[model samples]
Target: MCACPAQKLCTCSASSLKKTSNHRKQKRLFRKAFFFLQRLTRGNQTDTFRGLLLKSTCSFMKNSIFSLILLFSAALTGFAQDTIVLNNGDVLSGEILEQTASHVYFKSAAFGSISINPRDIAEIRFTQDQLGEITVPKDAIAKNEAKPPNLPASKKPEKAAAKPPQKDTSKKTKKKKQWSGQAGLAIALRNKTTSNLSGVYKDEKYETYRLYGNLNWKGERNSLRWDWTYRYSEDEYKIRDDFFNITQKYNRSFKNKNLYATAKTLYQRDYNRRIENEYLQTAELGIKWFGKDSRVKLSTSAGGGYHIYDRLDSSRSNKTSVSLPKFIFDENFSWKILSAQELEIIQKYTHLGNLDDYHLVFSFGVQNKLVRELFLRVEYKIDKDTEVFYDDKGYYDKALLTSLVYKF
Candidate 1:
C-alpha cells in the first residue's frame, strides 16, 4: 500500500521516516562535532585512526545521500498517490457501476455492497484508500450538529436564534460523467431492381457487412465520440482494408429551438501501405435537425464534403486517373416502434471529378434490443450509379437487403 497524499500521513509510515531521519541527524552531528574539535585544536589528532574515521564517515554520508536519491526517483516516476475529491466529500476509491438515468451505483468501500442512488449525485471519487483519519465533510455528518444533548435549553439561544439560517446550497448539483458505447453488427444484402441505373452491368448481389463500435464520453456542455468500423463483403473479396475507417466526433447541445447537426472530417496518410498511394483526406459538413427530441428522428444531419483520393495502388491503375475531389452528404434517422425495436434510415451521395461518376445510396433498417447490451438488425438498401461497376459497386440484383443480424 502507498501513502495517500490527499490526507495526512499514517503514524507508522511517519515513524519510519522519523527513524531514518534521526539516524542521519546523529551521523551529521557526530561529523560536525569532530570538525569542531579539529578546528579548536589545529594540527592535533593527525593520527591514522582519526583520518580513517573521517574517511569512513564521509563515505557513509555519500552512500546515504545516493541511496535516498535513488529511492526518491524510483517512487517519484512510479504510480504516485491519487485521489478524487467529491463535492459532498464522500470518497469512492474504485470503479463505479451504472445502469441508466433511474439509478447509479459505486463501490465506496472494499468487499462492501454498492450503494444505489435514486437521486442524482455530484461527481464520483476515484482513488486508493490510503490510511489516515479520512476527513468526512459536514454534509456527511450527523443532522444535529448545532445541538449538544448535555446543553441546558435555557442556556442555549432561544430556538430561532440557535437555528442560524442554513446556507442555500440547493443550486449546487453535481453529476458525474457517464461512459456509453454501442457494439452492433450490420448485415446487408443488396439486389438490383433497375439495370439501366448501373448501365453496362446487370443486377448483381454484393454484401456490405459492417461492425460498428463506438465509445461516447458524456460531459457537461460537450461530449466526445470515438467510432471505429470494420466492413467487409460476405460473398466476394472486393475491398481490402479500404472498408475500415475511424473517426472522432464532438457533440454538443445548444439552446437553438429546432436546429442540430454533426460535422466531421477524415484523414489518412496512406490508403495502402504495402503499395504506396496518394494521401487521402475527407472533409464533410452538414446539419439536419429535429422538431423535438421525441420526434422519432432522434437526430438528422445533412452535410456536404470534399474528398481527395490521389494516386491509385498501381501507376497504371485506371480507377483514379489523378488527384480527385468530390461531394458527399449523409442523413440519419431513428424511429422507435416498440420498446424492443427501432427503425433507422440513412441516405448518402458521392461524386468524383475523374470520370464524372455519381453515386447515391439509401438504406432502411430495423434494430431490436433484445437484452441488456445486445441487439439484432435487418436492413434494405439501394444504390444508383451511372458508371459500370466491376463486381462490388453496383447494387445487388434487386437493390434490396435480406439477412440476419447478431450483435454483441
Candidate 2:
C-alpha cells in the first residue's frame, strides 16, 4: 500500500506550499525558544521567573519538541518508497498511486505525479508493506515491450526484432495425367478390285463394320502405346472379308531434344486376300515437328525389319509360309481446323524382299467433338499390295468409315 492518492493530488497549490513553508519557519523558531528556555532554567531557579511563567514556558517547549520530531520522521519516510522499472531502460523510485489497464499513475519526488502507459513498465517493486495494493499484477505489462536481460534499465532499449514471413499454403501444383485411352466403333463401305483399264474381271463392293481402340501411357522419359483394329465385310449373300490387326510400340525420348527412338511389333490376319497370318517387327528413330497439343503436327520415321506371312492358295505354287527382309517408312500429321474439329493423315510404306513387291497404306480422317469426351469421326483409307498370291492381280483396297469415339 502507498500513501499517494489514486486520483491526482491538488495539494501542490500555492496555498499549500505557503503552509509548508510556515511549518519549517515554526520549527526553527521552536528550536531557538527551547534552547533559550533551557538556559534560563538551568539552575532550577523557578522562583526567579515566577511559577506561572516558568510552568507555561516549560509546557510550551515540550509540545514544540514533539511537533519537530513528527515533521522529521515524515521527511525520512518520503525518501524510502517504492521502485518502478520502465521498458525504455529508465529507473524510477516513486510510489505507485494507481494502476489501470491503460495507464499507471505514479508519484515521484523528481517528476511529481504522472501517468504512464502500462506497456512501458518493465517491473514494479514495493519496499514497504504499507504501500498501496495493486489489483493489476506485475505481469500485466505488455509482452511486446519486454526488454532483454543483457541491457541495463539505465541504457536505451534495442529495436524490436523483425518477424519471419508466412508461407503461402493456399496454392499448390497439380499433376498431369499419365495415361490416356480411346475406344471407337465404326461402320464402313469398302471396295477391292484387281482389274484396272480393261474390264477383264468383275469388281467387288461390300459393306463393312469395324471396331478399334488404342491405349497410351506416357512418362517423363518414355512411353508405350497399343492399337487394335477389327473389321468384317459382307456382300448380299455371304461374309467376303474378315480382318484383324494389333500393334504395340515402345518409345524413348532424348533429353532436351525432340528426337525419339521406337520399337514396334505387329500381328495381322486377313482371309479375303489369302493372308491367314502375318507378323512384323521394326526399330526406328523419329523426330517431332511440333508439341503434342499444337495446332499442326507432323512427323516422319524410317526403319527396317523382317516380315513373316502365311498365305492360302489351292494353285500349283502355294506359299504357306515365308519370311523376308523389309524396309519401312511412316508419316503422320494432324491439323486442328477449328476449336472442336481436327484433321489427320497417316501413311506407311513397306518393301518386302524384292523391289517390286511392297505394301502401302494411307488414311485420312476428320474428327469433330460432339460432347465432353465424345467425338464423331469420318475416315477414308487406301491399301495396296504389289505381290499377288491368288488369281487377283496386285490387291487394291479402299474403305470409308464413320465412327463414334469415346475417350477417357
Judging by TM-score against the true structure, name the best candidate.
2
lDDT of 2 at 222: 92
What TM-score goes with each of the models? 0.41, 0.56
Query: Per the 3 Å backbone cut-off, how many clashing residue pairs does candidate 1 have?
Result: 15
- Whole-model Cα lDDT per candidate? 0.49, 0.74
Q: Model 2: per-residue lDDT, tens digit, 242-287?
A: 7899999999999844788888899999765567679999888888
| Tens digit per residue, CA lDDT, model 1, 197-298 | 223334445555666677888765466778776655433323342345677766665556345345455543322221133333434433445455463654
Whole-model lDDT, model 1: 0.49
Off by over 4 Å in 1: 1-177, 192-203, 206-209, 234-242, 267-295, 298-304, 311-327, 340-357, 383-408
